[model samples]
Target chain A: MSIHRKNVLGAVFLAILGLLPLFLNSYWVDVLNSIGIYAILGLSLNLIVGHSGLFNLGHAAFYAVGAYTAAILNTHFHIPVLWLLPLCALTAGLFALVIARPIIHLRGDYLCIVTIGIGEIVRIALINNIFGITGGANGIFGISRPSILGLTLRTPTHFFYLILVFTLLTIFLFHLLEYSRFGRALNFLREDAVAAEGSGINTAHYKLAAFVLGAAWAGMVGNIYAAKMTIISPESFTFWESVLMFAIVILGGSGSIFGVLLGAALIVGLPELFREFASARMLVFGAAMVAMMIFRTQGILPPRPRSYDLFETVEGERKA
Target chain B: MSLLSIQRLTKNFGGLTAVNNVSFDVEQGSVVGLIGPNGAGKTTVFNLITGIYQPDQGAISFEQASLLRLPTHRIVSLGIARTFQTIRLFQNMSVLENVLAGCHCRMKSGILSSMFHFPRQQREERAAIDRALKALDFVGLRDQAENLSKNLSYGNQRLLEIARALGTEPRLLVLDEPAGGMNENETAQLVSLIERIRGMGITVLLIEHDMSLVMRVCEQIVVLEYGSKIAEGSPEEIQRNERVIAAYLGTEDG
Candidate 1:
């Protein structure tokens, strides 16, 4: 597609989305909020899984850490949930750095297995109420709602706008990251680590940075999730949650932002729409997933190879 | 002093000694060849020098600084860039992006700056693109800059690897089997490309099986046999060395 047409299509899509909540009922608005949240989470996981080619089946561990951090702080100390967003991100990022340091050297399926173990371990820890801060299996409760400019956001409509704004901001920032030097480095290392290292890219460092940054973004999303639900538990962050996020990235197009968002809508929103299918819904969903995978092996919106204007580069060189 | 020095280097894989007590020096502004029969440990030595595999014994120093435990990327940043025996370009990336990846260590724009496209980041990116384009032009793949590297012909793929390495702006260029599968025409092109690279004053270290190409370009040659250095000399001297000839074409009795 031409750049102009793509921009126009994107603008039209955003306009439709912006006008959606007005027409929908509370339940559908909440569903949109869910899609937005999952979209951000998929984008985060895409950095590690799609961009860097790291198998990460334990992203929920980081999301859980963020949610718990916010929940604990808000419930025990009465801190505003919004105020804990950065802290949640810090805690999750640190957690990823610590856990990933020793195991980052493991290759392929080994790394994937280790991540799965991590997700399970975090869930079990929360269940056991380690350090007595996690409140055992029942999980923390009564997380206060977020407020903005002296307005306490209470309705699904209120949270929708908040999530919409946050999702837009995430898209903007991640789009920049996707085109940057760092993004190229991730793709390079993903393609061939030995060659990337030989070409002067610090492969290990870039991989770990991707891990930490992805985890931090997931953590921020966790804070929003806690505020939206006003309650949290170990059940909310099972290994299944991680699988959903992973599927969203893979099903949408591993490295493409639009693919992830589409994946999120299909995975999260479709399931909701299928509610009327009753017991047969999951069966249909499974068959649809299988068909999608077979039809689009590279995902629905695989990332396009980056291109630069040769004449522009030549002009730049001449001017220089 | 030599630009890169290796002394008594050895690396063993489990029960087998892949490289044993190998020693060599790459002098400044020289094209050197490490040639041998298959499984002669030539590539192992290259790996050791590039820090892919640490030497079990002895030392490697670049510009008089110890390279003992430095990582591969660190070694490249210290001015040694190499291509693989098998072309390892980022298959899904554009040719320009592959070269841009090679320019990574030379450009420094942190995550925040990159995300924001800050003035410094934009400036560095522009400079990197220019450098990458120049390298692509050098390898005569400038017109295919936006093509996915995997889509290039085999010969062009090999040239793309060279362009990627040159993007590093290295002091020493190490190529593993540059002419492994090239035709006569491609090999001829590579010979001139090496001369042009040498004219740019970058030291060249290569492992090539094509004797004619090696004889035509290499100023110094190191011959290895079964993980041991059998001979080291100029092309003419190596041509006369009995052991080097025997290693390549076996003894009459055998």
Candidate 2:
């Protein structure tokens, strides 16, 4: 069957999921909500990791920025969680822009290191000086849930719908972005930065844009995460959490939107499905990632071009 | 004013000088070739002009604006674009998509408009797609627009690279080894294409090792050796210049 048909069927399958909360247990509903959050985070990382060819290991920094922004806004001012969603995303985007000038110049492992450092810094800061407001090691409690048009998301069922909507929106946005001009530019940059620049793409600007936008998407998810859990702490935005997001992108396929969602589901949902394997979870995850690198480094599904049959002859040339 | 002027442009790589004190003028709507032996810094000159490297001294002006300090994309926005010595089309993209990427800097849209698929962004995207198709057609690869750049034949890949460069609608297009790995027939086609590109009123600056191809198409030739200018003249004049002959053709008379 054609790729287009396959995509349509996938969409239809997802459309049927609007009623899943009716059948799923509350525990499973929580798993589903977590999957939604991770899917958005994974897809956001794909923009930089897959499309822009920039390795960002500290993506959780944006997640932290988002969480903290929402946490502080709601905890102190008693602001509505829904009102702070975009604000959180914008804050993370601005943070990305601030560091993008110097950071965008870094590549591969260096970029990874810097991002990792940024994540650590953000976490450390939250745990230290901001303790008065953030509650530091004690963490914040009584965090309010999101409400929409007088509807409060107090239960797993209610929040599942909101999370599901946001997750689908993130996927749709990423899908649109992957086919857009900016998406093409990021792909070009990923393939070859020099070539992309020569082609009249402002490589620095596009890289920065990708960084900022990716952070913003992750931030939106973080905002939802803050509301869902009704508590926040630096511990929630740890280095391992960032690594987990990276794992999702890499395990699924860095640039593929569906692959990201798939990765998120596997990483987030599998844990709940096999809670008996709790002690071996991290070990199994590590082994799977290593095996994937050894076997299918590109992930379960490599990112296919938006346009099919784009360059069959180039492959022929390589083979020749 | 001359369309492009480089006066005493110099670049140093640690202890080595890659581009040393070179100066030249490219008039508007002319095809100029930069030729040299291996490591002659021909590509280095291209790098300097395109903002890949900062010249230690001297100035580069395009349309009277100093391009020395401008970033690579900014230089491109100023109507200058280039291709690499190796074909560098976005390998996974369609020939049309690759060219469409080239057109990105020229198109205008707000972030919100692009994100929301606003009517304005859609119109610009449509225009860009049309322009991309036109560019591919110009390179005689319109039929291959849907083909992946990496899947194109070597010659077609080179042509796609040129087409992608042209997508920026540049007034000045720099080609690095346009006919680098092409067969004879492909080279002949490239010579004509070079002519056609010039006919489109775009000034061309090229670096090539293919002597016959360079001699046939380039109205002016600039020779560099060890990052320094050795000769600058018309192609006919360069063919006979003893220094060029010695530096390039070398001790072998043939």
Top of the candidates by lDDT = 1
RMSD of 2: 4.7
- TM-score of A-chain in each prediction? 0.96, 0.91
What is candidate 2's lDDT per residue for B1-254, written digit by digit as tens? 78999999988889998888999999999999998889988888889889989889999999999997778988888899898887777887788898887898888874566667777777677778777877888889999887788999999999988888898889999999999899999999999999999999999999999999999999899999888899999988998899987886567655
Check candidate 1 and list the clashing pairs.
none
What would the TM-score be for candidate 2 when compared with the true structure? 0.93
Which residue runs of candidate 2 sit more than 4 Å off their true CA positions? A1-12, A129-131, A308-320, B249-254
Give lDDT per model, in order.
Answer: 0.93, 0.86
Predicted complex 1: DockQ: 0.81
Candidate 1 lDDT by residue in tens digits, A47-127: 999999999999999999999999999999999999999999999999999999999988989999999999999999999
lDDT of 2: 0.86
DockQ of each: 0.81, 0.42
Candidate 1: CAPRI quality band: high
How does chain B of model 1 score on TM-score? 0.99
Per-residue lDDT of A70 in model 1 = 97
